[model samples]
Target: MFKYLKNDLPASIVVFFVALPLCLGIALASGAPLFSGLIAGIVGGIVVGALSGSQIGVSGPAAGLAAIVLTAIGALGSYENFLVAVVLGGVIQVIFGVLKAGVIGYYFPSSVIKGMLTGIGIIIILKQIPHFFGYDADPEGDFAFTQVDGENTFSEILNSFKQISLGSTLVAVIGLAILILWEKVLSKKAKIFQLIQGPLVAVVFGIIFYIMFGSTDTFAIKTENLVSVPIPEDASSFLAQFSFPNFEVITRGDVLLTAFTIALVASLETLLCVEATDKLDPQKRVTPTNRELFAQGTGNIISGMIGGLPITQVIVRSSANIQSGGKTKMSAIIHGFFLLISVILIPRLLNKIPLSVLASILLLVGYKLAKPSTFKAMYAAGWKQFVPFIVTIVGIVMTDLLVGIGLGLGVGIVVILYKSYQNSHFLHIEDKSNGVHKIKMTLAEEVTFFNKGAILKELDSLPKDTHLTLDVRKTRYLDNDILEILDDFREKAKQRQIHITLLSERGEVENPDSYIEFFRLRPKTA
Candidate 1:
């Protein structure tokens, strides 16, 4: 892991800057104590990173779970009671891993996965636009279409224009400029520039810019628009920030239900991120999904014990790490250390950095994930892939992550069924040999009940006095419904004065009486 220290160190710093505000903002959105987010970030980074099989995936408190945490806390009657749920949730996740539930991730289509990445990319860009212009009404980490401030996504963008902070806009522009310069030109010029990432430089610039113009009337960036880390007064006070779970209430009904909910949601989110991060990985390495579940479960357990929000493998931080050229999990581990140390030591300094700078960084990350090229590529892959891909993107933008994926997956299944119906059998008609219509129908490799409609329609349309060869020699599996359809077609064939020949690997039959009996007597051979 240490072999790529130079690469990991710089990437870790970039991920640290990206994760800090998200940790605080997600906590704020969840209505949890702000410190809880940091604790989750710390634990997710260190514990999960060390245990995980993914080389580049980063774990932390997720914005996706903010609403759940909010309701769970209220329903459970106390924040400490909610912590009990989180711990139990971790146990459930571990059980899911042992049961190999992680295989569920593989069941998702590639179109849906790509749609997820693109949808998230679009959400990040839309959500950060307000922050980019210095409108701070919405929390940085909230990814929902509907805002807690009683405003929707587009309305917030309109509001941002009315509430723009000149200083923030100026700082954001400069920060973005520096980032682009470093990425497009400087990093390519020297190893030193690569060792010191552009985001670090931009953040440093943002702090200096704030200190210089934060007091000015026309260009002042307010304290509200900056990164806010909880400041502890002394050693004893700092230690007081940690909250222990109330295990006494673990057996309560509400607690158990909340635990199960958290486990299911967190496991699903982690598996999705694992898939997305693996797609984004430059090395194209596959992450062990079940192992990732175990790692995340372990992280959540530790996080909840110390009063942290539930943890999951978050795509934003993971993408930031990958884009920053992270080579290994060392970057994630080091970022956790950074989170731990900064909150403890230099939180005051951290508070000086502008949120606009971080927003600028995320804008770049979002653009990369939802690049126009990806859309074109998906379109070129054909409607089967494009329909689900587009639907997923729209669903995610209009709703949330999971909902969008579900919508896309549904569309993808429909596309599969339609294709199956169309491809059930291939018809080849010989040109009226000897003045009698001759047709040959070859069944597909697997004919399920969904194929029954197409087969029935073809059989119904057969010409009178036709010689039909129904070939099933190549078919490996035939549904019972299709066999019944064929048996009924035999009577129709006799009424139409059509001669029917059944061709299979077993033998040839003249108008087979019972298709089911024939298949039962001569079962599929290996």
Candidate 2:
């Protein structure tokens, strides 16, 4: 993992920038001490990153879990007791990993996975718009359309235009221009440009710009619009920030229930991030999901013991890492160390960097994820994939991450069911004489209730003078529902003056026997 330091170090800086505001924002949203988010960030990066089998996935506090964390803390009576639940949650997650529950990530359709990435990309772009304009009210990590601050995504963006910060707007535009030039031109021209990422350059430029413009009336960004890492007044205050979990609370029934909830939710969320990261990986490497869960569990355990929020693999940070050219887990590991060292030593320096510059970095990442070419490519892949992909993007945009994913999955399942219903038979129609037709219906290898509607519709459309043949020789399984439909259709055929013949593995019958007995379907074979 350390072998990719050249790429990893630069990428880590980008992720560190992305993770910083999110760490604080999620902690703030969860009603926890602001420093706890930093603690989680450190543990997620160092502990989880070191242990994970994923090449590009980065772990940290998740906005999706904020509500749960908030309620759990209040329900548990104290933050220390809440930490006990977190530790127990980590233990439960470890058991889930041991049971190989990570396999569930594999079951997500590829379309849904692509949709997730695209949706997240769109979200990043939307969320960063306000920050890009130097709007400081909404937190950096709130991805939901309806923010915790009670403003919708688009409205916040509209409001940003009214409260524009002059220095921030200028820095953002210049920072974006530099990033675009560095990536699109300089990087291709020289290897040095690739090693020194655009984001790193943009951030340094932002810092200098902040310093240079402070005395000028037309420039100088505000303290609220800059990166804020909590600064401890003294060494003793810094030491007091870490609060140990109360292990005695582990025996409480409510604590155990909350632990199960966190384990379940955190495990599911981590699995999703793992899947998204694997898809986003340029090399198309498959991460070991179980190892990922184990690493997350370990991270959470450490985080809780040290006054941090519970941790999970986060797609935003992971995607930021990937988009910034991270090639291995080393980027994630280094970013965690960056978080640790930054808080301890360079909190004031970090506080000088403008959020608008970081917003510019993420805007490019967002554009890359939801590029127009990606949309066209997905559209060309056929509706089965395209529909779900589009739906996922829309769903994620309209709601939050998991709900959007769930919506896309729902659409994907409908597509599967529709396809399954239409694929159970081949129908051949031929006009043999005046007002007479010969029709052949060949059953598929596996026929079930899903095929009942298609078969019945075809059978009902046969003309009075038609001679129909039902071929079941290739059919291995037939649902009772289809058999009943066939039985009803045969009686209707008699009334319509239609001639019917049945052919099966057993023998030929001129519609003289029970449809069920004649078909002789064994569902087990299917």
Candidate 3:
């Protein structure tokens, strides 16, 4: 881990900048204290990173759980009660890992996985647009369809723009320009730029820009739009930010429901992040899913204990880590340390950075995830892959992440069934001597009810005066529906003057009394 310090250090700084806004934004979206997000980020990075078996995965407060957290807080009647659920949710996840349930992640089709990553990328880009323009009405990085403020995503952006802070916008543009130049041009210089990451440079510029414009009376950019780091004059004041869960609420029915909701959502988000991070990994190392679950669960427990929001493996920070050249788990670990140290020592300095600048950094991360190449590649894979991929995208866009994935999975299953049905039986025709056409039908190993349609279609397509050979040598089991179809086909073949031959272990039957009787013969040897 230490060998790649040159690369990992710079990447950690970039990931740190990317994670800052998201931590605060997710907290705001969750209806939790803004500091809770930072707490989660810190714990996710340090604790989860230390325990996780993934080389590239990064953990933090997730946007996917914002709705659940918000709802849980209201339903439980207190944020403190919800913290109890968050901790319990972590414990449940650990149990799930111990039970080895992580193997379920392997069952998702490759096309669906790609679709998920691409869909999320698109969401990030669309969701961050308002923030990039210095809009803060819905927080800096909320990705849900409906925000905590009860405004729709697009509407919030419009409203935010009407009250746009020129200072923040100007800083954002400069910060974005610096980031672009650093990546496209400056990084190529091979010395200064490579050592100092673009995000770090952008953050520095943001602070400078804020300081320069902050004192201008005519600028009219409110300090509320800037980074709101809690300033603690002493240790006791700093400790005030930490809130413990109300143990009295632990036995409540609402608390249990909230716990289940958090567990389910956080586990899913962590799985998604693990998959996405693996894809982004340049080395393409596969993460241990069960271990990842355990790590995330531990992180959530620690975070909740410290008045933090529930944690999960977050894609935005992980992607930034990869794009910025993170090479090991050290980068993730160091980023968490930065979060901890900065909040403690340099919060006043951190407070000088504008939210719009951080938004610009995330905008780039979002664009990379939702690049046009992703769509083009999915389309090139053909409709069987593309259809589900597009369905998932549209579903996620129209609704929410989980609902969209469910829709995509449903479509994917249908596609699988259609393919299976079409390939369930094979048909071939040969011209034989004496003007007789020999038709051969080979059934698949296992034929279910879905195979009925294909069998019927093939039998109906046979021409008159054809000699049909039905081969069941490889078939292990045939559905009753298929047997009935064969019986009907036999009667039709007789009417069309088609000669039918059935091959089974019992013997070859030139003319069978019934399909059921024909299939009652001894099973064929492999």
Candidate 4:
């Protein structure tokens, strides 16, 4: 893990900066104590990173789970009670891993997965825009269209325009400039630049800018526009941040239901992230999905025990780590340590960092994920891949992560069914001989119910005095419904004066009396 210390160390710093605001913002979005998000981030980074098979994936409190956590907390009557649910959720996730439920991630279409990454990228860019101008009404982690602040995504953006902070905008502009320069020009030119990282410089610049102009009326960034880490004056106050689970309420039906919900959702999100992160990885390494779930479950268990929000493998931080050239899990572990140490030693210094600067960093990350080139590439993949991809982006931007994925998956399934329907068979009209139309219909390898419509249409349209050659030689699996359809077509053949010849691995049959019996007697294997 430490082999790539030079790369991982800098990447860890970048991830640390990226994760800090997100931890606070997600906790705020979830309506839990802000410190809880940091706890989850710490546990997720250290615990999950150590245990997981993934090299680049980062785990933390997720924006996708904010609404769920918020509602669960209210439904369970208290945050402490909700912690019990979280603990239960972790146990359920472990069971899921043991049951090998991670295979569910494999079922999603590649188009949908691509769409998910792209959609999230677009959302990040859009969400950060408001914060870029120092309008911090919505928490940075809230990706849903409807916000906890009673403003939808678009409305919040509109509101941001009305309340723009000049000072923050200026700092954001300079910070972004520094990032672009460092990444595009400086980093490539010098090893020192790569080791230092552009994000760190931008953040440092933001802090210095804040200190310089803090008292200026027009140029000063507002306290609300800055990172708001809870400052503890002493050890007792720091320890007071931790909240324990109300384990006595663990037996409640609501607690169990919430736990199951969190486990199922968190597991799903983690698996999806695993798939997406693997795709993004330049090294093309595949993480073990079952092991990932187990790691996440363990991390959640630890996090909940200390009053953390529900955790999942978060794409944003993971993507940041990858973009920053992190080569191993050490980056994630080190970032967790940074979080642990910073909160204890320099919470006040952290609070001085501007949100706009972080927003600028995320802006770049978003652009990389949702690059215009990606759009062209997706479109070039053709409509089967493109439709679902676009739908997913739209759904995610308009709603949330799971809903967007659901929409994309639904579209993907339809595309599969359509493709299956179209490709189920090949029909060729051979030249007529002896004034009789000779047609050859070749069934696909696997003929299921989806092909019924296409096959039935072709059969019904056959002309009178036709010689129909039904080829099933290459077919490996034939559904009973398709066999029944062929059987029903026999009557039409008789009425149309069509001669039927069945060709298969078995000897050819002329005008078979019972299609079903013929197939049943000569089993598919034979």
lDDT at position 314, candidate 1: 96
Could you tell me the lDDT of residue 378 within candidate 4? 90
**CA lDDT, candidate 1, residue 497:** 92
The TM-score of candidate 4 is 0.98
Model 2, span 4-32: residue lDDT tens = 89989999998998899889888887888
* TM-score for all models, in order of appearance: 0.98, 0.92, 0.91, 0.98
Model 3 scores a TM of: 0.91
The Cα local distance difference test for each model comes to 0.93, 0.89, 0.84, 0.93
Report lDDT (Cα) of residue 331, candidate 2: 95
User: Model 1 segments beyond 4 Å from truth?
Assistant: 524-526
RMSD (Å) per prediction = 1.1, 2.6, 2.8, 1.0
lDDT of 3 by residue, 126-224 (tens): 776666666667776577777656777677767867877777788778888998999999899888889898888888888877677766975545676
Task: Please report how far candidate 1 places residue 30 from its true position, in Å.
Answer: 0.6
Clashing pairs in 2: none
Worst lDDT window (10 residues) for model 4? Answer: 517-526
lDDT of 4 by residue, 1-526 (tens): 7789999999999999999999999999899999999999999999999999999999999999999998999999999999999999999899888888889999999999999999999999999999999899888898889876578988988988999999999989999999999998999897898889999999999999999996599887888899999998899999999999999998999999999999999999999999999999999999999999999999999999999999999999999999999999999999999999999999999999999999999999999889999889999999999999999999999999999999999999999999999999999999787889999999999999999999999999998999999998998888899999989889878988999999988868899998888878777375
Q: Report how far off residue 197 is in candidate 1 (Å).
A: 0.6
Candidate 1 global TM-score: 0.98
Candidate 2's C-alpha runs over 4 A off are: 251-254, 434-436, 464-466, 487-501, 504-512, 518-526
| Per-residue accuracy of model 1 over 398-477 as CA lDDT, tens digit each | 99998999999999999999999999999999769677998999999999999989999999999899999999999999
C-alpha lDDT of residue 53 in model 3: 92
